[model samples]
Target: MKYNNPVIKGFHPDPSVCKVGEDFYLVTSSFEYFPGIPIFHSRDLVNWEQIGHVLTRESQLPLKRVHSYTTSQGIYAPTIRHHDGRFYVIAMNVSNHKTFYVWSDQPNGPWSEPIIVEGLAGFDPSLFFDKDGKVYLTAGAFPGFGPEGIIQAELDIESGQLITESKFIWKGTGGSSPEGPHLYKINDWYYLLVAEGGTEYGHMVTVARSKNPYGPFESNPHNPILSNRSTKLPIQATGHADIVQACDGSWWSVFLGFRPVKSTKVHHLGRETNLAPVEWSEDNWPIIGNNGRAEIQHNGKSLPLGEPIPWQGKEEFDDESLTSVWNFYRNPQKGSWSLTIKQGSLTLYGQSSTLNDYESPAFVGRRQQHFNCEISTLMEFSPKEEGEEAGLTVFMNENHHYEVAKTMKQGKSIILFRRCVGSLWKVENETEYDESIVVFTIKATETDFTFSYTKTNGELEVIGSGETSLLSTQVAGGFTGLYFGLYATGNGKVSTSPAHFEYFHYLPGDE
Candidate 1:
């Protein structure tokens, strides 16, 4: 059964897959986002379900300096494996610059405490156990110039520590930044797979092999076994891959890729997860595409005809807590946000007044999913002080954010479209309002954003719509995704004005 490109959609990237007896489990990178390393269970390698998250507790992760411009923190690419009744996952938490491993007898685990591996200085670390029962760790390290390449060393299986000396493997093909290395053995050769060409438009996967586990290896003549180079397939970044062989011996690869929306002139879906089949050549080298580069289109390979699971773009707060779809930019203070099922609404408490403030609290948001999606929120904002503000925002970083806010101007409450350009927050547009409860909706189409609002009025009307590229990756120099959050701020004293979020609805297409 041929499957679509993104086997798992929305913000899941840097995929690693493992198979055990008919069961397949997949894990992906969770940069800066809490509850790091999402784990999924699949039977056919095509259809997948999220079973759990690996780093759910604060002690398992170090979150300081998490919301910086780089926004790089928490866990990176994670490698999952099942051996001797123990399911193990090893990953690096860049915030503390350490590699850690967690193990459990079951795939859905009561996982053990993290075993930290010291002296490692790079990202995207992976562990591989050979047939001889020797555990080897491979990772990508920067030599200060650019993305250096892959390094391999023996790791003590019991202690989760490095044993043998580290050795350099492939330094890339002289043109790309080689990272995300995965090691495997087929026949007598140990294969090292590396991603190069950066994670942007030129992203690709290359393979090299050696007779010995630590080697002088040869590059695959069919290098770049998979890529989306030919068409610039809207989804620009498409490398950082991991491979798994299904129980039936069919080969499949899970990797990271993304699609950019013109309206946001930025990516909202984040780095999505993609799946493709691999075919081996007569020479034992892997060839991914029938034509040349990897294709996103499904070719009806091996999938069930069951109806697609309907997904929701909107969320109701008729629950005790937030759902998995709602995630904070960094580690959240539990008491800061809540939803009372009986009250049937979300409450965000006032904290800091500005987005630049580290404690600028009162924030609950969802990942911007589609390029042309519509998001509307029912909100009641009551601000107390002069600089106190509360509203809805499309947040990129501390410095890059756009908001539609209800502010207490003079004695009256007014709605304004505010933006943080460079370092200043400016009121670019505003409308005088008298309503106590308001409904605000932001329609993002192709790189354009339109702000609209409604009171007791029949329907909302657009306040202003303009071309804005508020959603950028770490390139715009922040590690945060474009978030739709309800925020409240105060000048010095905490604002007594409470904000109620009735509901948040995000529709991918106009419905």
Candidate 2:
């Protein structure tokens, strides 16, 4: 059976994976969102289960800068490597400007606290363990103007320190900003894989090889072994790859790419994880995808298809805790949300901070995995005063988001459809509704997002609509995707009434 691209979808970017025997574990960069570094497990590579996050406690991830409009400046590129039965995840927190790592005996686990890599001065840090028990740290300078090239250093794995001087390895094939480096020893030759040309439309994967782990590496003869630049392919920004030799002895690569809106260069769903087959060249270099390019649907070698992951869109609040897919904007405020208080519903106490504020409001969201999707939530909220609101939102950053909320305006309970794009904010529509409970729905198309709500008569009424491009990275200028979520806010005062959401049902159009 053939496999599809983006084996994992929606906002998951910079994928680094490792195979632990027949089971594969992968981790992606989680910027600004708490419970950072989401870990996944898969036995057949095609089916993945989100086991948990790498950082669960605030002590391990001190992210004070999270509750703000600081942008996508938290955790950057992450590389997950397994060595000698221990799993290590190395990443750079841009907010702290520190390259640190956390280790665990199991992939989904109670990982150890953060251990800062002293003297490892660069972003996109990756760990490579050689056969001789020597550990090497390779990374690219921060994502900036000039290409400082990839740097390498001998690392003390246990002490979390750099034992050797940081040396500049290959400058890349003259690509600007060569980063996301992962080094591997294949067939007695040290192969270094990296993403270059920035993470935009020009993104690409290039390789170099050296007989020694660190030395004057020779660039691949073809160079840029993988890229989709200048092509009108649906999958763009394809780079930042990690190759693995599967149990069947076949090589495959996991990378990041984005699906633009139909006939448009806007990708509001963010970069997603994609898979491609890999083959070795006659010259010993690696070949990725279809001659250095991947497709949305790939017809590679047929393997035993794994069990299908059942698609259940209805989200019930029956669990004692939220599942692995739910994430907050940052560190959620204490007492802002509770699942125990409402029994079969989620209770969110509205905070004074709004979604437009530089602080955390009561918001819970999951990634918009499909471009064509529908989200509906049954919310019961009685607005006690003006500015107190609870409803659904399509969010990107503080500057860009769309909301269909139930609030009190001019002492009248009403349904409000507001859009926040850049510095401009507008209430596109509002309808007076006397009911305290209503069902809200957001229908996302490739071109537009439709907002609607149910009236007291149980009939749905369209309130407003928005262009999908407005929330895209091209127009919004951030490293994140769209999130359709439930939020509660008092605008500037603590809400007197808590919003109880019975359930959130999401139906993706892709299926």
Candidate 3:
């Protein structure tokens, strides 16, 4: 069977996979988002379903605020491994520079609270359980381990402490930031895999092997076995991979890569999760992806393809809480948004904080999954004050964003098209509207994003447009992508009015 490169699309990056019995479970990094570490379940290597998140409680993952200087810095690379009868996940929070691990009985879980690991001035931590029941923790070099290289320490899993001495293993084949290490005992040999070249366009996966778990490991003859750097491949920045052997004894890898827009190095959809087959036959050394490169389409063996998961393009706000697809910035304040107050409509109360504020604003959104997609929403709001505005926004961060809103200007309701690009903040256009409710639409393409609204006569009228390049990672300098948001804010003062969002529609170009 054939499957697309990004089996799981959008901002789900730094994918790590593990298999238990007939099922394969995957986990990815969620930076600055409320519930961190999204976990997925797939029977076959192709079809995947989002089971739940590993960090559901704020106590486990406290994101008070994001680095204003950095874009995506909450949760970093996570490695999920299944041992004994429980599932374990170990990852780091770059915001605090701390590594922690969690475990649960079920894949979709109310997992245990975090167990913070001490003294690992590094990131991207992984757990390797040997056949003798001993677990080793490996990651990027820290304090005593010296420079950029891989480090290993015997982890006292029961206490989240390193029982054995931490030491430097193999400083990779001279790559910029060697990180994201995963150890696997394959075919009686200990295999150590790590990503290097610093994630950007130069990201790559390299491997080494050792006779023992902690050793003078030998580098693969084919060093940097998997990389798409300096290539014209659609899937660029290919690295940060985890290999999992299927129940059928076949090996596969799940990694993170991004598809740039319009043949350029400007991506706003963020790094997505992709899959590729791993060959491990002749030399004991592994061959990942396709000749050290990932493709847009992969033709591999299928495992009785499971039922596809339903898309959440249309949401009617019928449930008491937001769906799993929905996410909030940082830590949303209580009473900011509600679905119970107004049945079938999402009610958003405008807070004093705006999207530009460092603290959490009254905003809720989902990742802009597709480069070419249409987004539409119906909202009823009458701003009592000038700063009180509510509508749809294409958000990357506080500094880089574009919004088409319904706001009060000079005692009259008006439509607004605003863009925030770095230091420049400007309102491109605004028009007077007599109605309390208006339907807003945003159509996105590879080059630009066009804004539109419904007229009083039910006709669609174009508002304004923004360049998609302005929001790309190259221009904006962030680790994340865009989010289509439903928001209400008072700029700096609390609003007396509320905004009612009736429904939301997100249609991919193909859909």
Q: What is candidate 3's lDDT per residue for 333-358, written digit by digit as tens? A: 88898898889999999888888877
lDDT score for candidate 1 against the true structure? 0.74
Each prediction's number of clashing residue pairs: 12, 0, 0
lDDT for model 2, please.
0.88
**lDDT (10s digit) by residue, model 2, range 1-511:** 6888788889999999998878899999888787888999988777788999998887776666633445887788899999999999999987777789899999879999988987765789999999999999999965452447898999989989789988888888887778899999988899999999999999999999999888789999898988999998889999999999888888999999999987778889899999998988888888998988888887657545688677667888999988888888878889899999989998999998999876778999989998888999999999989889999999998899999999998999999899999999999999899898899999998888999999768899999999989999999987989998899999898888999999999998863
RMSD of each: 2.9, 1.7, 1.6
Against the reference, the lDDT scores of all candidates come to 0.74, 0.88, 0.87
Clashing pairs in model 3, backbone N/Cα/C closer than 3 A: none
Better of 1 and 3 by TM-score: 3
Which regions of candidate 2 deviate over 4 angstroms? 66-70, 143-147
lDDT-better candidate, 1 vs 3: 3
Candidate 1 lDDT, tens digit per residue, 181-215?
98999878898988888877678898899998778
Better of 1 and 2 by TM-score: 2
Any runs in candidate 1 off by more than 4 Å, and if so which? 66-69, 106-110, 145-147, 261-268, 358-360, 468-470, 478-480, 491-493
